[model samples]
Target: MRNNLHSRKINFVQDFLRIQNEAVIRRFEDMLRQEQLKLAEADLSYPMSLEELNTVIDQAEKDDRNGRLTNADDLKKEIDNWE
Candidate 1:
């Protein structure tokens, strides 16, 4: 399976390098960008691992102990004064 994938990637790079049309290259660039954006959005929706969740919770606990949080009433009042 690894060898098959390696050969496919090699062939794709060869084919991609032979392209002479500017518009076709731009289309491939656009498609690659769209796929990357979709992958990023998908990454955001997955649950974090236990260690990651714990790290976030730890940070929040430290922040709370240090009085880094604001209450809802203060937040609403601050937002109301925003330009």
Candidate 2:
């Protein structure tokens, strides 16, 4: 599923890059923004269960132990280089 999602993302970028119509580009941008807003709102609407909270904590602890963590400054620097 992850691979499929990644491939779909690449295809979407390819499709987006081929677009030349200004109106179509504006519509795509609006739709994408709306979908992202819906996703964010949905996340905030959910109250985490005790089990879910514990799972998140466990993942963080594992990440810490495995040294799979990024500090805020490093993350911000990385984000600045993103397209």
Candidate closest to the true structure, highest TM-score: 2
How many backbone clashes does every candidate have? 0, 0
lDDT of 2: 0.98
lDDT of 1 by residue, 9-67 (tens): 99999999999999999999999999999999999999799999999999999999999
Predicted candidate 2 versus true structure: per-residue lDDT over 6-77, tens digit per residue: 999999999999999999999999999999999999999998999999999999999999999999999999
User: Over 4 Å off in model 1, which ranges?
Assistant: 55-83
In candidate 1, which residue pairs clash?
Answer: none
Worst 10 residues of 2 by lDDT: 40-49
Q: What is the C-alpha lDDT of each candidate?
A: 0.98, 0.98
> Which TM-score value belongs to model 1?
0.60
What TM-score fits each model? Answer: 0.60, 0.63
* RMSD, one per candidate, in order: 9.3, 4.5
